[model samples]
Target chain A: MNLSRTARALLWAALAGGLGVVYVPLLIVLLNSVNADRTFGWPPPGFTMRWWAAAWESGGVRDALVTSLQAAVGATAIALLLGTMAAFAVQRYSFFGRESVSLLIVLPIALPGIVTGIALNNAFRTVLEPFGVSLGLFTVIVGHATFCVVTVFNNVLARLRRLGASIEEASADLGADTFTTFRLVTFPMMRSALLAGGLLAFALSFDEIIVTTFTAGAGVRTLPIWIFENLFRPNQAPVVNVVAAALIILSVVPIYVAQRISGVEATTH
Target chain B: MFWFMPDQEAAVRLIGLRKSFGPVEAVSGIDLEIADGEFFAMLGPSGSGKTTVLRMIAGFESPTAGMVELGGVDVTRLAPFERDVNTVFQDYALFPHMSVLDNVEYGLRVKKVPRSERRERALAALGSVRLDGFERRRPSQLSGGQRQRVALARALVNRPRVLLLDEPLGALDLKLREEMQVELKSIQREVGITFLFVTHDQEEALTMSDRVAVFDQGRIEQVGTPAEVYERPATPFVASFVGTSNLISGDAAHAVLGKGGTYSVRPEKLRLSDLDAAVGADEHSATGTVAEVVYAGPATRFVVDLDVGGRLVALQQNLQVSSMEVTELRGSRVRLVWNRRHEFAIAS
Candidate 1:
């Protein structure tokens, strides 16, 4: 159990090295947002807020931000409802092919993003094309929701496993019927888990690109797609960096809140 | 619901109740009645179907056959919520997310009781369990014993006709369990509600119950008062299960007591005397060699190998003998004597 001083020092060094490697690119993106250099020259770059101003004023950026927010929120809402139901069904009841159903739910996140995107694109084209519907923001939300379900499912499933059926049984024994027990006891216990799961599902949908690329029509542009397309354009790359910086800042709030909520849950018991 | 009337009508009744899970029959045919306001204990070992019976009473399990009647009402098809009963589960099963007051008030909330009245009644229930100051604490914030009291308060706040307790004190330590047993009995007396307690501990059942039913292998072996069941057990299983009994049967029964078939003699009833001690007219005597001595705190037990071809356990109170003298009696030859009237016939 006792680690040598040299070994402890080496472990600390490795952890710091890992964190530095992960954050260095993010730091560069933040720095490049303010760089005055036209081509993002590394050393001689002066500081300016012109790109931030440009990003704030651009109609395309505003529209894409709205679209991404709508898709992420819609996907997260659907994921929370479906994932919690699926978790409860699989956890509380036993039936044929239950294991297969669990595996199928996790398949979207397990498979390569390109494969899931292509499959969803093909299925959507066949199913919705027959109804005279073209791919739009709705298709993007659907695509994001497919992978997002797994995050919510895993979070809620873990919570359900920790919260056993005994309390619910006790509630019933105390003369509260099924719906009453759920409202008074079950929902309150699971509120934190649901919030954590929904936040994770929202974050997953927000950063997704491959599935969005395949499912979105010409009229729809999510923030990730907008960033990708602007990354190669000569005049708009710094503005793209500004948008990425803003997205990074926006995504941290939910992730941090999820971590805190789950942390509180772990300590409460 | 007059407190002292002790309603003689059956508070709970089971008529030919049976339950089976696929192939395993957990509870076979059972017919029983629990009088109103009586503290009835179902005593059995693990897998003895005692808990299954309690669950059936609580409406957690519907009988595969027969019916359950509560106060002349057939509740065989009712859900747990529909039944006018509450269960103190083995683990207490308090809502971890709610405060102790909230848990106690849950039943009232379900009935749409007004919030202020719910709070006052819940506080009163908590006071009955001697947990008044713990209203704001969550279940997770309390110890095992506190949680148990909270569960008791929660069940009592509903004022159900019957309270089914599934080994409510099983989780506490020995000292705490004994204290809670006394407290539970007093609480039951104060509440005057029918208490159907289920436990595997024989001493707990005997100490707390007005009537005890001994269960074995999905059937009731015997049902009687604590003393009646212990003294005059209807079956050999009951005689051995309720407490330690020296069972002498076959030729040994004939040789020792001039009886054939089978009989049970309580260990405490057997007396050890000098090797050549003369037996009185009303007493039966058997010469035996001491095989082992077990020193319990309040008494000393001697396992004697009888000359009549059976091993018998005789318990002597430690009040008269010092520990050294009891130890010296180990492996000594002795005569075991007991009055003939003390022996009871046990069905094999």
Candidate 2:
């Protein structure tokens, strides 16, 4: 396991370079949110809270945040239900084309967002347009859900694979029926996996942009779509920085909560 | 003590039971009767179908052809939970999410027993397994042997009419396995429940079981008490599997014992001495050169290349001999002797 000094230094340098590339833009967004200069010059003339105050007061920002929350929550809820069921079906039973079914469940996410977005937009318009339905928050939620399912399915499938059926069989042999065994044994064991997957699915839906653009009809702007639209505008560009900064700060809570929950599951089990 | 009650029925019965997976027959045809309060073992190698029979009795498997009866009632098609039997699996299978007490109380909880009574009975069962203070600890926190006891306590708390143990001691080390064998037997006697134990370890089956059924390739080779199975094996598989046997067949059989067919002589039954050593006039003898000497502390086994054209392993109890004495016997000419009556003819 010995590593030469040069190799160790190279690994550390690569990690630091990767981190800088990832976080430098986020740092720039944070600085621009507080920059007193109107143009967001390379070096800030001074710092101020004016952009935060402006973002707080904007009606469009408030409405976009609410829409994003609604879509993310709807997508995550549906993903949790469908994803866990699919995970169980794949992990517990052998059926024809089980591998193909697993591949199909993951295909939506593996496909490029623009492809999925355009395909879904076309399907929704063609199928629902005849029935007098129009694309809105529901269509956006459906679009986000198609990709969010893969995250939840992967997490749950890993957990189910680790938790083999011997314990379940032991429960049945001890007089608990199938449903009772799932309630008392299976659910509690997989609770943390579900939480982690749900959080990831929610986060993926919350910040999605490309798919949201195609699926949302007029007047249905999610936070990411709103940010994209305002980023190029002269007056609202700083407020867009404020929104991105707020998103970066708020995302910490769920990611931290997920880490702690899975950490506890790892230790106690 | 006589534990069987007068009104008791046979705890488990298999009537021409057969099980197959597609083309592979796991248990071909098995008819067995286990008495109430009996400690029965199904002894076999892997793929020998002993565990399949136990699973069928526990309602975990459905026989392909025949019926399994528990307490004289047919239960072949019943689900595991509906049958009056529980299993202590080979892997211990304790729920890692639950504490030890909860694991033991799960069956009672499913049976709708009161919370307090469930706790009390679970604690009592844990106490019997010498794990009373571990009720609050998770199964992952316990040692391997401790987890095994928890599995045992969990099944025992159900108070099923029959307990199915599938190599419950297979995971333990040598010393712990021996200890658990004694503990398991005593616990079975104390509970007076019929125990259908499945194991491939011949010594474990011999030491713990009152009666054992030997299995070979989806068929029962023999069924008898441990002494009968070991000393008076009814089949070649039973003879070789239960203990080390020197299977002398064909020409070797005729040269050694003047028998025409196959016969088995236990290694410990044959006595070895120097080539010119005088043998008892009534003893069956074979002349051979000592090819190898294995020092096994309590007994020394000699591999003899017989002049009759096969090898014979003769084990001698190290009563007065030292390791050096046994080591010196290697490469020496030897005469292997055993009582003629000790040769049991094996019906091939």
Candidate 3:
């Protein structure tokens, strides 16, 4: 384990270099949010809270925030429902194409987001146009759920595989019916995994832009879309920095919560 | 025949039970009747279909053919919850998320027993298994033996008419396994419930159950008291499985016993002495050279190659023999002697 002083020094330098590459840009965004220079000139010349105040007062930012929340929540709900069912089916039983079903469920997350967005856009137009339904917030939610399902499915599937069928069988032997066993025994065991998966799915859907852009029709603008659209506007540049800085701060909550839940699960196991 | 009592109502009966998974027939055809309140053990090696039969009786697995009756009621088609029986699974299967008390009371809660009554009963069950103060602890906090006791308490709290235990002690060490064997037997006696215990350990089967069924390759080779199965194995499989037995057949049977059928003699039943040792009128003696010697702590085993054609093992107690003395006899000529009654003829 002993290392020469020079080697250790080199390792420390590499570590610092790696971390700086990742966090330096984020720090710049926070600095630019308060940079009074409006052009975001290097060194700023001065700092102020005007951009933060402008972001808070903008109605467009508020509307985009609400739209992002709705899509994330909607996609997370659908993911939890369909993903858990699929995980159970694939983990606990044997039927035709069981492996293929799991692969298909996880495929959307592995696929390029733009490809999924394009395929979903065409499919929605073809299937929904006949029904007089058009792409909007609902289509955005559906599109996000396709990839979000992978997170919930992987989490629940791992949990189910770790927990064999014996406990559920014991419950049934002790007089609990099928539904009672699931509600009392099986569901409680997987509750943490579901929560962790839901949190990750929500975080993923929240900041997604490419899929949202293709699936969302005119009049629908999620927060990421709003940020992208306002990034180029001359007047909204400082406000965009404020919102981006805010997003960088807020994104830590769900990721931290998911890590804590899964960490607790790991220790319990 | 000695264990079966026709007058007493059968607690659990399997009539021509059969089960198959795809191409593998787990349990081909099993018909057995266990008496009320009897501690019955289904003893076999792994993949011998003992667990499958227990599962079918517990209603966890439906039989491919035939009926499972509990106290004169047909329960073959019933679900596990509908059947009036509970099982202690092989892994103990205690809920890792629940406290010990919660796990024991789960059955009562599912059955809609009142809170106070269920709590009192669960505490009593835990006390019976000697796990009283460990109620609030999670299963993860307990040792293997403690977890095993929790599983037992959980099943016993239900007070089912018939309790099924599937290799409940297989996970524990030797000392703990032996201790639990005595505890389980005592618990079965105290509850006055019919226990259908499944195990692959022959000694555990012998020590705990009132009667043992020796299963081999999806069929029951023999069902009798421990003494009956050990003293008189019905088949060659039972002879070797239940305990060590030397099989003498064909020419060896004719040469040793002056008979022409298969015979089994326990190694411990044969006495090793001088090659020219005198044989009694009713004793059968075989002259052989000691091929190998195994010096166990309490006993020494001698593998003797018979002069006629085959080999037989003789187990001699180390009561008076030293290790060096026994080991030196490895190449010496010896005679294995046993009473004529010790040799039981097995049907081919």
Please give the RMSD to the true structure for each candidate, in Å. 2.8, 2.8, 2.8
Scanning candidate 2 chain A in windows of ten residues, the lowest lDDT window is A249-258
Model 3 quality (TM-score): 0.96
Q: Which candidate is the best by TM-score?
A: 3
Which candidate do you rate higher for DockQ, 1 or 3? 3
Clashes of each: 0, 0, 0
| Alpha carbon lDDT at B263, candidate 2 | 83
Predicted candidate 1 versus true structure: per-residue lDDT over B285-309, tens digit per residue: 8899999998888999999999889
Against the true structure, whose DockQ is highest?
A: 3
Question: Ranking under DockQ, best-scoring first?
Answer: 3, 2, 1
Model 3 misplaced stretches (Cα beyond 4 Å): A1-9, A41-47, B1-7
The local distance difference test score of each candidate is 0.91, 0.90, 0.93
Error of 3 at A116 (Å): 1.3
